[model samples]
Target: MEDESGIFARESAYLERYVQLGIASGRVISVSFPAAPEDDAEPDHPLLERVVAYLEGERDDFEDVTVALTVPTAHRTVLEATRAIPYGEQVSVERLARTAGLDADSDDDRNVVRDALASNPAPLLIPDHRVRDGPSAAPPEVEQRLRSLEGL
Candidate 1:
């Protein structure tokens, strides 16, 4: 497990650390940091190593890891665009909507983007933190730490 230092070290209402891997694809789906730590958590998983490397700032990108997400059809484009955002980069909701081929000027599209990010099932894997105007599903401090890791 990665050291819970800096922003991660602090206790938050949502700080639950656990790894969820896809059964069929054998890929990491979500790595949550909830308030209370779990006892007897699984310690050895290949994907956990990668996730640790990421949180510890030892890795720059998660492109090699496949993520499992069940986004609604309306929100799929926004999530896909968010997933495409590179490590350390940030984009506004309008820009993200444009990247997803949605109308950048349409409030509906921007709201869709925001809603998608706010409800992201796979937080770190999809990197909704990279979206500037969109609401983050992860804790704000965690998001800031991730941005700092990327030097964004």
Candidate 2:
């Protein structure tokens, strides 16, 4: 498991909601901080607990065992990481914010991008389907929300 400190833990409320609702989505798992403290003795947050359990395969029946999607810290941009797609690699606004170093936890900013994507559509040349959650490859809706972030 990666350290949560250096990784700048994204609030990811939608991800929590999706996971709570049993929505399966992929993710880009990266170990940003390898030397951070471990809280394995007791999970502090529900999402943290779920993430730990999921990574350990304790929740196998509830989610997929294979990690199909992943992006390392080495790849600065999602589009840069997904160069193999050839064409139609939609870069969401949220990704832009993350690239520009914005607050990923802000609902208002996230919604702004979502609204822009829903309204304009073409600037988002890459398909939302490509943006995985972490390593598990979350559902389309999760990726859609990610790609819909504002000012990407």
Candidate 3:
């Protein structure tokens, strides 16, 4: 877990929405602060709570949460396989491609995995940091931090 005093979130009305996570320094990717909290009793704020909990060191798999991913078919396949990566575990891009039903030994297949992760719409939800042997949605430092947090 990391210190969450700087934590912030932008919630969505839809139950499942894409989120970009940057855990290092607690900088919420593409987030904005209102300078003052709103008083609205929005019922769809569970994502905020779950993200806060995850930052606070909870071992949340996040499988319970859904996301609306709109990507190319190849990217979608790779991202969905990435999403199935269990907490504290990792796999190579070739392996991930294989899991996604692509030929594991094909360079093109592996590149697709890399490109898909680079464009991942839901970082934390997809856990792209777990892709050990290729490009990740997380920045280098952020990826290291996330892996450390997962006890890898």
Top candidate by lDDT: 1
* Candidate maximizing TM-score: 1
RMSD of 2: 16.3
Error of 2 at 105 (Å): 1.5
Total clashes in model 1, counting residue pairs 3 or more apart in sequence or in different chains: 6
- Provide the overall lDDT of each model, using Cα atoms, as 2-decimal numbers: 0.68, 0.33, 0.67
Candidate 1 yields a Cα-based lDDT of 0.68
Residue 102 Cα positional deviation in candidate 1, in Å, after optimal superposition: 0.9
How does residue 127 of candidate 2 score in lDDT?
29
Q: After superposition, which runs of candidate 2 have C-alpha atoms over 4 Å from their true positions?
A: 1-96, 123-126, 132-152
Candidate 2, after superposition: displacement of residue 111 in Å?
A: 1.0
**Stretches of candidate 1 above 4 Å error?**
1-29, 38-40
Q: Considering TM-score, where higher is better, how would the candidates rank from best to worst?
A: 1, 3, 2
Q: Report how far residue 29 has shifted in candidate 2, in Å.
A: 36
> Which 10 consecutive residues of model 3 have the lowest summed lDDT?
12-21
Clashing pairs in 1: 14-34, 15-33, 15-34, 15-35, 16-33, 16-34
Better of 1 and 2 by lDDT: 1
TM per candidate comes to 0.78, 0.23, 0.71
Q: Write the per-residue lDDT of candidate 1 for residues 1-152, one digit (tens) a residue.
A: 23221111222222234444332345444556655434534455555566667666665566766655677876877887888898878998889999998898998888888898888877778888888777888778777766777776
| Candidate no. 2 TM-score | 0.23
